[model samples]
Target chain A: MRINPKTLEEVAFKLLEKAATSLPDDVKKALKSAYEREDSPTAKTELKNILDNIESAEKLKKPLCQDTGMISFYVRSREIENFVEVRKALIDATVKATETIPLRPNAVHPITRKNTGNNVGEHIPHIEWIYTDQDHVELIASIKGGGSENMSALAMITPGLGVKGVKKFIVDTVVKAGAQPCPPTIVGVGLGGTVEISFKLAKLALLRPLGSRNKDKDISRLEDELFNLINQTGVGPMGLGGKTTCLDVKIEYAHCHTATLPVAVYFQCWADRRASAKISLDGSFEFIV
Target chain B: MVEYRLKTPLKEDEVRKLNVGDILYITGTIFSARDQAHRRILEYAEKGLELPFNLDGAVIFHVGPIMQRKDDRWVVVSAGPTTSTRMNSTTPKLLERFRVRVIIGKGGMSFEVAEALKRFGAVYCHFTGGAGVLAAKNIKEVEGVEWIDLGMPEAVWKLKVEDFGPVTVTIDSKGRSLYETVKKSVEENLKKIYQQI
Candidate 1:
């Protein structure tokens, strides 16, 4: 089935707009739950204010965070006839969304520090395409906020150190990151991969819904254990000292060389901005949460 | 734990009285500066050039607001605090040269910046990060902007604010720092956790 470029652009713009102004249902639920579990008075107030901010942004149709974040598109598609058109549509939609949704002009040239103003520079809205067997195309759009993005870390450990070493690295990153990543953060851990692949997996893990566990029992156990250890550090909401420092911890792993264990830790602030959509050959699109 | 309503062009006494963890609802006027604006201010100080705005007793917010035109005037859509540590390299100079009494941002700054805050009789305040929409509600007006060439995020925004904060004093003039305390306590806990593992 061939999808029209115009239809794809429209769908992309809607996804970008929705991703900017509203928190996903899973993220909203997690924040509410965190607010209830938070023990510190300051943390509770911080959580309440964040919840209020989310509601106001949604109601007013404005961005939930000022940063607006760098746009990322993760696409899972079957054989589509208009693949090239789809790419162009995604780019055009980003420019249109910048003006209509009025996103902050976040794309800047590294050497000269020139802002593109339209949120589209060279590779500004990062797109990753994954082929699948499904007849329809599914796209997951996520915004990686600057505050949390700054805290991403990777460590190459010797295989002898094992899971215990990975745990310490993740915990230390969270500790040092502290209030910088804007706790209670959603932590994504990638283990057993090479340097770059591990980091990619770490970010991919964030696309998973909050509170969902890895299918592997061992990995899921690590997620649960790390979740508690991170929260116990008392970094709390906005790192103001509390019982609920981390809302969730997710782990994604890949096979690595026998000699090296590369672990990447990524954090997403509680804003947790993301949305998904499915597009059919008839040029129709449906938002999935 | 005390809540205080502070007006800008703040007095030394007003700044000195702030303790770590005190909630503040600051009013009056405040200027916004991120890393680039701060660097320019330091450069201006170096060249002995007169600044576009007065800095004495000023409260500088670390932010890059999302502004759009509304009814022929600029309105802030969202204006949350940026991380302050990124500006730590320039903050001590800004504090000393500008005599800024209050610095507001998210996450805490480093020891050097904290010490500068102490020496200058200033305090570092922290607003909730990513609560840009909530913060925008407190901004009553966009007075003017300077260094437009620095781009939106890097420009110096003069804002008129009223009861403009749901902020906490994270680093106080008396050498007390909530971030430092938290880090130290967390380190102690890490020791125990590591042993258990």
Candidate 2:
């Protein structure tokens, strides 16, 4: 089955708009509960401000944060004939969204630091593909701001150190990142892969909805353990000090070489902006979040 | 923990009175300068060149707002704090060169910046990170802009704002820092967690 490139472009543009302007429901619910349970007046104020900011952005149809963020599209399809066309359409959508949604032109040259004006540049609007037997095309758009992105970490640990080392690294990263990534953050942990794969998995793990556990019971238990350990730090909202530091911790893992253990951690700030859509071969699409 | 409504071109006396954790709602003019702009400011000062805008007693917001041109004027769609820690190296010098009374951003700054705040009679404030729309709503006007060649985000935007906060003082002129206090406790907590896990 084939879908029109124009339809894909429009869908991609709307996804960018939706991702930028609205905080996902799962994130909102987590934040609301964080606010309810928080004890520190300062932490509560920060959370309240965030809640108010979300409301204003939705009401006014404005981008949620000034850092509209680097865009990434995760596409999953079983059989699609227009892979090249799909890529082009997504880029075109990004260029259009930069002006209409008025994203902050975040993409820049690494060396010279020249702004691209539109959010597109070399290797930008990074598209990741997954092939599945699904009947419909699944596209997930995630926008992550620089502050949180800067906090991402990759650690190569001794194999003998095991899960305890992984847990230590995760907590250390969060405490080190205190207040910068805009807590209460949602942490994504990627474990037991090659260096790059671990980092990629960590970022990909962020696409999962808050409160969703991994299918693997061991990993799910590990997620719960880290979540509690992080919150116990009292790093709190905006890291000024309070009870809740992390709203949720999501983990994704792959089997590693017998000699190596690589762990990567990624943080999504409180905004946690993302949206998903399922596009049918008939050219119809529905936003899932 | 006090709340004060301040107006810029703020006096040193007023800034010195602020304590860590005090909330401020500021009025009048402020300028937005990120990493690049901060570099340029120091460069210009070193070259003995005059700046396009005044920095004396100014509020420097570490933001790169999403701006749009409607007719002839620039409108701010969203303006939020960028991480201030990135500016730590240059900030002490900026404060030393000018009477920059309030430094507003997120993630706080280093002990060096806190020391500079103490020395220069200024305070570092945090405008809740990622609260862009809220920040823009309080910004009344884009009074002017400079260094457009530096690109939209890096350009020096002279903003007119009113009640432009709920910004909290995280590092005060007295050398007390809310971030430092929190960091100590987090470290202590980290030690405990390490022992358990």
Candidate 3:
């Protein structure tokens, strides 16, 4: 059985619309907790404003952010028969959604600086595919804003520096990026992979639900330690000064050569817009969130 | 810590009176420009070419809003502030050449810009970065736009705003920078964390 391209396009458009206006359950919960835990009046007010903005955007069916962001797709599939059509459907749907959902024309040439005007340009809507034993395709769509993307960092430490160095680097990145990426921000820390893969791992780490803990107890402990270390910087909500600088810390690691330990830190603002769905062969779909 | 209600065509003294942490609710006309737009403006300055709009006593907003066409007219959908640091290199020149009284953006500017703001009697205000929907609600009109060749995100958006901000002064004409202060305090916190670890 195979899903028709038109149905895929329809599903993709619906996913983009939801990604723009709705907040995921886990992220909403995290924001509510941050608001409750906040102490400083200024920070508390900022959090309240952010929550209000979320609610208003939902009600009005408008994007929560101006920089609608570069769209990304992570697909895990095994039994999808028209794989080629699936790719084209995703691209076509993205262009269609640009006008319907009214997403910003975010793709532009780096050198000539030409706007594609359709949110479809060279390597935009970056689609990454992963194969799994599953019989259906699971798709996760995320809109990564510019301000938060600007705060991403990559650090290479000597082998002797160890995990301690990674912690220091992550904390330093958050401090240097104070108020720039919009706190209380979600932090994704990638450990051990080489230069390029480390950055990719950090970004992929952001796909994990906010409150979900890592399977590795040791890594989960590290995530908690870094979370506490980052909040200790006193960056607070919108960097105004508060106790809740970071909402959550997620870590992912891959084995690498013994010579160097490369770490990457990725930040996502409170907007944290992402949604997922499972696509079936009968031209039907159900949202994962 | 004062609260100000400023209108565009801002006066020098009005901007000079702002201090770090002062809140402002601004009204009137303002132009939006980001990284590429700033470069084009500076290029115009170097060539001694006349700018498309008057800059003297004007306020500049750092944004790349998402807009949609409705009833054959364009309307801003989400118009939140962008990071100011990206414009730091070109800002002092813009301030010096245009005599802009106020700059509204997120993220603070550099020490160089702080000095320039002091020299030019200007101030930098920070609007909440992710509050794009709220920001759009405050816009009264989209008067006009230019530099379409620079693309939508880099285009110069001329907006008519009314009581359009819950912005805070992050950099004032007195050379005070809230970001710098935050950095210092963060360093102190980092020191304590290092001891704990």
Note the clash tally of each candidate. Answer: 0, 0, 0
lDDT of 2: 0.92
From the highest TM-score down, the ranking of the candidates is 2, 1, 3
Q: Go through the candidates in order and give each one's DockQ.
A: 0.79, 0.91, 0.77
Give the DockQ ranking, best first.
2, 1, 3
Which ranges of candidate 2 are over 4 A from the true structure? none
Instruction: Name the top DockQ candidate.
Output: 2
* Candidate 2 vs 3: which has more DockQ: 2
lDDT of 1 by residue, A1-289 (tens): 5667887788888999999999999989989998998776788899999999999999998998999889998888876777788788888999988877888888889998888888888987998888898888888888778889898898998789888998888888998899999888999988887998998898888999998999999999999999988887887888778887888999999999989999999999998998889988777789996
- lDDT head-to-head 1 vs 3, winner: 1
User: What is model 3's DockQ versus the real complex?
Assistant: 0.77
Over the stretch B13-98, how does candidate 2's per-residue lDDT look in tens digits? 99999998789999999999999999999999999999999998999999999999999999999999999989999999999999
Model 1 quality (TM-score)? 0.98
**Model 2 agreement with the true structure over A140-185: per-residue lDDT tens digits:** 8888999999998999999999988889999999998999898889
Q: Order the candidates by lDDT, highest first.
A: 2, 1, 3
lDDT of 3 by residue, A110-148 (tens): 888788999888787898887888877788888889899
Between candidates 1 and 3, the one scoring higher on DockQ is 1
